[model samples]
Target: MRPRYTVVASLSRLHRTFLTAPSSSDEGFDFIFYMTNKAKSINKALNDAVPLCNNPLVLKIHEAMRYTLLSGGKRVRPMLCLAACELVGGQESTAVPGACAVEMIHASSLIQDDLPCMDDDSLRRGKPTNHKVFGEDIAVLTADALIALAVKKLASSTSFGVSPERVLRAVLEMAKAVGTEGLVAGQAADLAGEGMSLEENEVGLKHLEFIHIHKTAALLEAAAVIGAIIGGGSDEEIERLRRYARCTGLMFQVVDDVLDVTKSSEELGKTAGKDLIAGKMTYPRVMGVEKSREYAEKLNREAREHLQGFDSNKVAPLLSLADYIVNRQN
Candidate 1:
C-alpha cells in the first residue's frame, strides 16, 4: 500500500501538474493565460454548483461529491464543451452550465469507476478514491447524487437563456453518452477485456477502440455537440464539432494509456502502470509505445481537420486543446 501521505495528492500539487498550459504554435495566442482564466471560471462554476454545507442532513454525500468533483484535473471535457460553444459564436457564459454539467457527469463516472466493484482503484487524481475515503456505500450515493444533480443542471438550461428545445436536445445527447451507448458500454467492455492477451486476440485494436470510444470519447463527443447545440450552432457546425470531439477524446485516452507506463504515480497524480499490472489492453501494450504515439498524432491531426472552415479565431482554443491532449505529460 502507498503511504498515507502519498495516497491523497494535495490539490495544489495536482493543479500544477494537471493544468499546465497547452503548447501553442501561434505566438499570438497566449495559451497559458487563456487556460488559466478558463480554468478559474470552470472551477468557480463547479464550486458554486456543488458547494459543501452542513446540510442538517446530507453532508457526507456532499463531501464525497466535492472531494472528487472539485479535486483538480485538466477539465478537458468541459473545456472542450466551452470551446465548441465559442467556436459557434456563443458567449462563454451561455455554455457555463452545460460545461459544469458535463464535468459533473465525468466526475460521477470517475467515482463509480473507482469503486471496489468497478476499477477497484484506491487512487484517483492524486487523491484517495471516493470509496476509499468515504465508505463504499456513501461513495455509491455520491455518484448517484452527482448524476442527478447533473440532470438538474441541464434541466434548468432555460434559465441560462438557452431555449427549451435546445436544452432538451443537449439533455438527450448527454444522456446517450452516459447510458448504454457511452461510458457504461465502454466500461463493461473494458471489464470483459481485462486479462485478455492482446497478441492472442485478433481483434485487439478493434476492441481497444470500442472500449475508449465509449468509455472516454463518448462523453467528450456529447459535451462538444451539446455545447454547440446550446450555442445555436448550425447542424453542419455541430456535426463538425462532434467529429472533432470524438477524435480528440480518443487521442486523450491514447495518450493516457501511454502515460500510464512511462510516468510515475507522482507524475500522473494517480497510480501508474495499473493498466499493465491489470493486464488491461492499452495502446502501448497492443500497438507498441512508438506506434501508440503515432496514433495519437494521427488522431490529433484528424481532430484539427474537423475544425477546418471554421473561423480560425474561434478554433484557437479547440486546436490548443487537441495539442494539450496529445502533449500532456499525464
Candidate 2:
C-alpha cells in the first residue's frame, strides 16, 4: 500500500469516530477539550515555575533563562511524553514533571542553537533570539542554567509517582540524548558539513543520518521511551514505542526540511531559507523534495502500524500527532 494511503486512511477513520463526534452537551465536550488544553497549560506553568533567584548575583541570569523558556513554542516533545505516559496507562498528572524536564531540555537546545557560534539566526518562535535580547553571554548562561535545572528538577520532582529506578533511567536517557554522543555530536557534524561538497557516499549519508537522528530524533525517542518507562510499560512495549518514536522523529525532520524550503519565516516562527544559506545538509538537499515527502509519509504509516496492537482510543493522539508532524505548516 502507498504510505500516504495507509496513514491517512486509518487516521481519517479514527478522526471520524473520535474527533468528529457530535456532542449532545457542550459541557461534556468542554471537559474533553479541557483535558487537551491542560496538556499545553502544564508547559506554561512549568516555564513560569523557573525560580526568580533572589540572589542579586543570579537574578539577571534567571530572568534571561525565563525569557527563552517562556517564549511561545509548540511543546510537542513534552506533549509526546505525556501522550506516551497515558498510552502506557499512567496518569497525566504523574507525568507532568518528566514532561517539564523534557521541555526545559528542548528550550535549552534552542537557546544554544540560536547562538552566534551555531545556527546564528536572530529570531525564534516569532521573537528575538535569546542572544539578541539578552546578549550572547547571558543567553549562553541561560541555556546552561536550563540544562542544569532540567537534571535537578527531574531528580527532585519525585512526588509525581514515578518510581526511583524509572526516574533515574529517564534522567539518564535524557542526558544521553542531549550529550556529546547525541545532539552535540550531531550539531558538530552539521556545522562541519557547511561548504563541503556532497559526494553521494554511503558513509556521508550515514553521517548525515547520525547527525539528524541525534540532533532531532534522540530526545523525541527519549520522550516516548521515558514516558513508557514511567508508566510501567513492559520492556517489549517500551521497545515498540521506541521504534515508533524513532520513525516519527525522522519523519519530523524530513517535514521540517521541506517546510524550511517551502514556507515563510513568518509562517515558521523562525528564519526560513537558513538551511539553504548555511548550506546545511537536509533531507530535501539529499533526496529530492517529492522523494523526501514520500519517505516521511512512509515512515508515518510504519509508525502507526507499530501501534496496531494497542487500543485505538489510547493511541489516537499519537497517531494524530504523527499526521500533524508531516502536515503542520510550522
Q: Write the per-residue lDDT of candidate 2 for residues 1-330, one digit (tens) a residue.
A: 332222233233333434444322233233334334644566556755687878988998888887777665556677788788888888877767777788788889999998999989898776788899889998888888888988877776467767898889888988998899778887888888776676743246676778788888888888888788787788888888888988899898989989899999865657898998997888888877899899988998899888887876577677767776766655
Which predicted model would earn the best TM-score?
1
Which pairs of residues have clashing backbones in candidate 2? none
How well does model 2 score by local distance difference test?
Answer: 0.76
- Across 1-330, the per-residue lDDT of candidate 1 in tens digits comes to 743232122323334443564455434775556666777898898889877787847988888888888877767778788888888988888888898899999999999898888889998876789899989998899889999998888878789899999999999998999999999999999999989965655469899999999999999999999889988999999999999999998999999999998999987778999998888999898889999999999998899899997998767788877887787776
Question: What ranges in model 2 sit over 4 Å off?
Answer: 1-39, 200-204
The 10-residue segment of model 1 with minimum total lDDT is 3-12
- Model 2 earns a TM-score of 0.87
User: Each model's TM-score, in the order given?
Assistant: 0.92, 0.87
Off by over 4 Å in 1: 1-24
